[model samples]
Target chain A: MRQILSIATTTVGEAIRRRVLLIILLIGVLFLVVAPGLGVLSARSETVVLRGMMLGIIQLTSAVIAIVLTVYMIPNEIERRTIYTILSKPVQRWQFLIGKYLGAVFSLGLMMALMTAVLVFVFWLQASDQSLAAVGAMVKAPTMYFVQMSLLAAVAIFFSTFVAPLVNFFLTGGMYLLGSLFNPFFQTLQENQGTHPVTKAFAGIVNTILPNFANYNVQNPIINPTQVIQNESRYYLEVTFYGLFYIGILLVAGILIFDRREV
Target chain B: MAAAIETKQLTKSYKSRAAGNINVVDNLDLHVEEGEIFGFLGPNGAGKTTTIKMLLGIIYPTSGEGFVLGKEIGDMAVHRLISYLPERPYYYEHMTGLELLKFYGSLFGIYDEAKYRALLEKVNLHRDMTKTISQYSKGMQQRVGLAQSLLNDPKLLFLDEPTGGLDPIAHREIRDLILSFRDEGRTVFISSHELSEVELICDRVAIINKGIIERQGKLTELLHGGRIEITVGGVDEAFLKGLNIPDSNIRGLPVGVLMDMPEEQDPNGIIDAVRNRKGTVISVVPRRKRLEDLFVETVTNPALGGKPSVPPAVAEEIVK
Candidate 1:
């Protein structure tokens, strides 16, 4: 446990020193500041437009941050031969994977919190009237975004354990795109049940294997105050837990493969 | 006593589909006794690094069993008691020397900062501990590398070209440190192309060539074969006549001549041969067998000329 924490701390320190976390934070803040101005030019309702823009920005930024940082964690260590120094110890392979994952997640979590705070501040500045429920709903979008990014980070790490960083980057991004498209395909399959059995079955298998990142998109519930937040809280927590579970599975697989690699 | 390290028929082959396969190490046996400085001498492409990697469990051997500290080579517990320094030390460039040492110490489960601090002092790296490893000279990096190896106070240490790039003073310091390790009853296994350094520090030395052990034994046994050189000027025929040395004893050289005496023969016979001659003797230098000469002779001769057979007892003893 101590070794894990030590490794995580070192990872965090390395990330901070490299200015990766700082770059992500600066970009996220800039996006939040500019999001409200973009909402003003939209042809839709003001609150709804602002919420959609904020959610889209958060998702895009978080994905960029997670993929860019996590993809190089293992590869950089291997290239530098720092893995040799760490693996020579009594620490298990699983511990090293978990430690790196947690470190990356923590870094992303810090960025998410900072970006979400900036978005909330912008929302508060533009609001004519604020309610407790409205504020809570507005915060849920970035919170869900955090969970999705954490899952993406794990996916990047999993691929990094076995392949090159550039390949892992594209592979994890492809998985994310495929996972996000799952919900629409599932709805389509349900609408055309008689026509698309084989396609529906294949989509179902992919949905089961990859994380459903689209499920965490909760912008409409917060933006359109007329619509009830049906299943919002339960689904948000459930999807967060689901992302955590997927991360755990990928991390285990990574550990297994990395353990057998001759370093 | 059990051997500190032993390998039986150790072999390793690297396979690449695009390129021709090459066997880095093949059908080799090696043993090092506890408290002895064993030198593993080989030229470039001689599988020295490959053998070290296998012993350290960085790379698995294709076929063989190796033991260290009476335990199997790959065992983690045995690894804890063994320290290694690679030919080129690679470290985190961002980390200072002290930070790197602390990280290594933490991995080895050593929490005492003072002990590591003292090790830095011992390796003469205390002054440069605050500087990043990337900024260090090759010799300075080697010093830090040596410091890290001694962090756990290991029972066995493997150093590959430990003093390869060091200046004369640093090289001497490292040699002294290795000798000190032997004095404290720890085993030190070193691989180097520096024949003179190996000869100076190693109690027992092994000369490997083409993935095989050409000769291995006590330094004294290899060096004390009793070869001498004699030089004299004027009256060549008279000097030859005065010396009744057999043909086997007298071998011709470019400048002067070489004399090979039986193991039991005294130097007095050569002294008498020159003394009774009607000529002024310039110099009668008694040539002792050096590790460099031995290395050159063994490597140049595919079948070393009438070399003494390696005793089976020595091989068996190292295995145990």
Candidate 2:
């Protein structure tokens, strides 16, 4: 356990030292500043514009955080031969993988929190004359966004364990895109199933394997305020649980693959 | 007593993309007793680093087996007893020297910071402990690398070119440190291209070439006993022409008459030749062979010409 903690701390220290954390912060701040400008010419209501901006920022920040951090961690260590010092010890390979995953997750978690704060602040600024209930709804949307990003981070780690960082980045990014596009594609297939049973079945199989990123997207409720579904917290919580479950499974797979890696 | 390290037909071959398979380490056997500084000598790309990496379990061998502290290597438990210093010292550049040591110690399950601190002081790195490793000089980095290897006070230490970049003083300090480790009953396996340094510190040495153990034994046994120089005065070129010494026996002359003579072989014949002359004998100097010359001779040609298995007993006694 202590060894895992040591590995974790080292991984975190390495991540911070690489200025990855700083870059994430800079991107998040930039997104927050630009999000309000989209409201100016939009035909959508102010609440809707704010919510869209919040959702866009969350998705963009989470995807970047997951892909960038996961891609570099293992490759950098192998290049530096730091992995040798750690592997020479009595520690197991699985421990090293888990420790790295958990450490990177911690870094991503911190970035998500900071981005969430900026999001809330932006929503508050746009809600000057609005009711507290409306502002509260806007603030609540990001909770689901965090769960989605955490899941993406786990998938990125899984790819990193077996492939090079650049390939891993492309793979995880593609998966994130697929996950986001899956819901609408699946719904369309289901609606046309009377004439397209084969296409519907293929969509069903992909839906089962890929994460349902769209389920955690709550931006519409924040933007259209009137669309806020009351007592829908249970659905949000279930999605969060689902995200955690997938992250856990992917993390286990990553550990197994990493253990067999010769390095 | 068990051998500190032993390998039986250990081999490793790397598969190359641009070329055919290259055997980095061929089927080879080796053994080093406990408390001995065993020098693993080989030229660059002679599989020296590969052998060390296999011993540390950093890489798996293509075939054969090895044991460290009587436990089969590439096993997690055996790795715990071994400490390795790579040829090029690389650490967490962002970490301070002390922090790097502490981190390595922690991985080895050494929780006490005090113990690691003492090790740093022992390696003469306590003063540089707080400075980031990136800011340190090459010598200082090497010292910290040495200190890190000693973090757990491992029974078997694998050092790959520990003195490569060190200054003369730093090199001596490291050599003394290695000697001290042996004195404490620990075993050190050192790989180096520096033959003289190896000869100076190693209890026994193994010379590997093309992934095979070319020679292995105590330093003394490998070197030839000595050379004999018989200088005769008052004998002109006419008398010298009458002598029947083989060209192989003559080692050139400012000081004349060089010959490799056995100790037991009677010096009477040569003495007679000089005494019978109308001239005086200047000197007969017996010179013992240096390690470097022996190393060159053995490595160049292990077959020291198909003479007798042993040299004459008298000359051997003089060397002993």
For lDDT, the strongest prediction is: 1
Candidate 1 chain A least-lDDT 10 residues:
A83-92
- lDDT tens string, model 2, B27-138? 8799999888998876556688888878877778889999888988878887778888877778888899889988888887787888878988998988878999999988
State the lDDT of candidate 2 residue by residue for A175-223, as single tens digits: 9888887766775676673747788788777777888888877777666
> Which structure among the candidates has the greatest TM-score?
1
Q: List the residue pairs that clash in candidate 1.
A: none
Best by DockQ: 2
Q: Global lDDT for candidate 1?
A: 0.78
Provide the overall lDDT of each model, using Cα atoms, as 2-decimal numbers: 0.78, 0.76
For all predicted structures, in order, the TM-scores are 0.84, 0.84
Worst 10 residues of 2 chain B by lDDT: B306-315
Consecutive 10-residue window with the lowest summed lDDT within model 1 chain B: B311-320
Question: Could you give candidate 1's per-residue lDDT for residues A1-263 as a string of tens digits?
Answer: 87777678677767766676577668878978988788879788887888778778878888988999999999887776666556655556677888898889888887788778888788888776576666766788888888888889989999998999899989999999988876567656646757467877876766678778887777776777777656766877788888889888988898888877666
